[model samples]
Target: MEIRLITADDADRIMPVRAYAFDATPLTPQRAEELVRYMSFRLQNTTLAAEEDGEVLASVSGIPMRQNLRGVVHPMLGVAGVVSNPLARRRGHVRTLMHDLMRRGREQGRPLSVLYPFRSGFYARLGYLGLTAAKTVTLRPEALASLLTVDLPGEVRLRRIAEGWEDVLALQDRFLGSRHGFTEFPEYRRHQPRDDDEHWLVTAHRDGRVVGALPYRITEYGGELAGGVLLHDGAIARALLLRFLAGHADQVQTITLSVPPAERPEQWSTDFAGTIASTVAIPHPAPPMVRVLDLPALTGLPAGEARVTITVVDDALLGGDWTLDGAGGALTVTPGASASEVRLTSAALSGLVYGALGPEEIVARGLGAVPAEAWDGISTLFPRADPWVYLDF
Candidate 1:
């Protein structure tokens, strides 16, 4: 089997295989043709595939994106379009294509690749571990009565989504300041509402300056008004909840919101029982798995000074001895260091770096073991900051 990168001309072959892999809504012939033309124009040369007998067996695509690692931004490949021909399953094609993609990322000094997984274990075996959580909560508007009575800081007003786009951008800039694990979706593709749905954008302003913006589409569920609010901060989240409760008290029964793992609904609501009458937390447990493409690049994330050695025991793509030195919030990760060795697999190392697990936990789970002093050093080298993506690609 031969693995190769796909150019614009190869979309005709790859898209069908991708549709099968994803089990996406079946596309009409005209829609498929339109997609082929559009994908070739948009995607260009960011796809990889494994071929046997001139037939593409498995494929994946990579988009240029970045991730916030402890208040620092690092380039990453937004991995997607992973698919294999059903007839060609279990031929190691997906694994081969992924290895090639990761190798390319490492060569470019792009240290990370993230993807929402179909199966967590499959990617876990390929040196990736869960790194983000999709926190979903459902509650009636009455549950938010607590926040409605309390005085909010900013002036809340309604506007069209396009009108509030700039305020949203400004708010995100302030919100993600010095924050770990967040990325901005550019204006060109901000996941705007589809054609049929109507949208309402609410902005919070203080001193005539936009501080926060909430944009969402209203949808009907079970013959009642319902909509899921996408948000990142606690203040804005509470304000939006209050707006929903106050404005649509009788019309809207339930308002759903997707937030980062740390922002619990109970924290803001008055009554926990009234708040979470349904599932307390609909946990989307790191649908995306993360892989460290470049050990030195990832190890170089900003932190206080510490020099530690890591020995990766499995998966040659990330296996080797790495000396990570951080001092004065600067990092220098170089090969050939003699020190207390922290031995672990590539998967375990990714898990540790991306906040999936810590050094002691990995050792306890039999994935890695470290000495007492080395454990302390590792903490200083790789500080714990939960990673989150604004949206899964």
Candidate 2:
């Protein structure tokens, strides 16, 4: 099988593969025409496919994105749209396509790649480490009633996304700037078509500035209210947004929102010890996985002064002995360093850098072997934090 980028003419071959893998509607001639027209405007140059005898077997798309890594923004590739034909199952077509995509991303100067996987173990084999999954919090609207009782400074307004697009982007920029593992939405996705009648953009304004925003959709005829892309400046903004959501109690039965791992919604209430009445928050089992493509490019990550040598084992992409030297709050990676004190896989290294896995946890999981003397340095250089991605690819 030959791995190559899919073109507009190959839509017919790929659509069936995608339809079968995703259980999407059967592809008809009209659907093929629609895909061709869509691809013409939103080109699929970044989408790779495996083909043999002029038939597409498997495909994956890599979307270029920028993600904040410990306060430093770096180029990242968002992997999505992975599919394979049923006839091609058990073959290595998907693996080949993924490897090609990773190589292309590295060539394009992307240091990291992230994807929400169908199976976490499948991507884990490809040197990707799972980060903490976002929590889906479901609660009765009355659970947030306490937030509405306060006379918050900010006022929440409901508007269409188009009317508040600029303010929304600005708030997201500010949010991404301060957070770790948050990725900015790609320009193409920002301009994608949306059903304005079904979706609403809720924003919180303080001093005539957009302090927070959340895009939501009400489903099941007031049975559920689902919100995502929730960004806020501070406690007041968050409270205001929660209050706005509480106002929907009469119309919506439950308010469901996707929150980052670090967010604790129950704390919003004055009584923090008790549960929010009947709130159920579930962390997604399969979180987005991350892989480091260019190790040297991450030298600029903020860290305390420490010097540690490590070896990455069984990694085709970043396998070798290296020294990580952090001095004056900046890290520098020196390749081919000897006297390694820690041994780990590329997935462990990615987790450590992303602040999802600490040295002790890595050792506990058997992902890495660290000497007693190296624990402090490793922990200092790669401090633990809950890495979260607000946007889903």
Candidate 3:
């Protein structure tokens, strides 16, 4: 089928594809249109497709974001409505569409891409690894004690984000600066109006400066979950979290949170003590993937003066690690060689991506090998920060 970029005018055709794909899904026509409207705003990179005969079949689109700190720009492409005609289901339309979208992302210089996959394993094969997780739990506020009692970290204030867009962007930056795996908010999206959910942005200040912030709000369903952006510092993060949970106490019965893999609030939340918990890997990574996309990128990324050559086997693809010339500013990953230092597959790589296990632990578990002393250095390279998504779309 002929695949091509779509424009606002094609919504009629695109909407039907979405409806056909999500017919059994919980999404309604309005929800589908709302999503289409969101995607339409990013006309440049957005894409939609139809069969060779001109029948719409799939679509994907998203805006780009910039982290002023890193001076890097990447678009967060959201893949949606990737449905084929029922008779064309077995055809590789989905795979072909995904490849086209990924190529488009790379062509536009977006090193990182994300999407809430219809099937986890399906995306894994496409090199999209599970990075972070979110825990959705149901608990009566009265059944759980008030999560916060002590004074907040600073001149803590809660206000509606809709009142001012500048305040929302400032708070979002503060949160993303200290966390990894969290996508940066794009300038356009910052001012882009939304109506699906009401957001209350809370901030804590010390000495008249904002130290932490969280964007959240309670719903009529008698449930409240940590939403939108979140700043660094677990204590301040927890404070904002507790305040949100506390406000819903007695009236709310479930408290869900989309958190960084390393920031496990359930472990520290007095409200959740003794409560059984479940978690799903979030769309973002707990510790964002750090591939040596360019050798120069890694050289300047603070690998430290100490260095060693360790072999890593990627079961997902090629195996064997190359000589890492820290002093020479080079990395040569190769395959098939005599015995070397460490060995691990892509599955084990996931463990390292998250803080689930350290280098030493991985080696002990027969996943990989590393000098005992180098473990600290290796861990330092991958900070254990919570991964958060700036936008669900």
lDDT of 1 by residue, 189-248 (tens): 344442223666776676677755556655654323344445535566456545554566
Model number with the top lDDT: 2
The C-alpha lDDT values of all candidates are 0.68, 0.80, 0.52
The order by descending lDDT is 2, 1, 3
- Those runs of model 3 whose alpha carbons end farther than 4 Å from true positions after fitting are 22-38, 48-50, 62-81, 142-149, 191-197, 214-232, 240-256, 267-276, 279-299, 304-391
The alpha-carbon deviation from the true structure for residue 290 of candidate 3, after best TM-score superposition, in angstroms, is 9.8
Answer with 2 or 3, whichever has the higher TM-score: 2
Error of 3 at 16 (Å): 1.7
lDDT of 3 by residue, 156-224 (tens): 677776664455556566656544444554555555533333677666666665666666667767655
Which candidate achieves the best TM-score against the true structure? 2
Poorest 10 consecutive residues of model 2 by lDDT? 274-283
Model 2 per-residue lDDT tens digits across residues 1-393: 888787667666666676666545766778767765665444444788898898888899888888989899998989977888888877988888898899899898999999888877778788899887666677778888777779988688888777767777787788678888888757766555242334688999999899988888888767988887568878899888988988887898887777777778778766423222222232224678899998998887898788889999887778899988889889899895474769988889999888888888889988889887888998998888777777776
Off by over 4 Å in 1: 23-26, 173-177, 185-198, 221-229, 232-237, 272-286, 338-340
TM-score of 2: 0.91
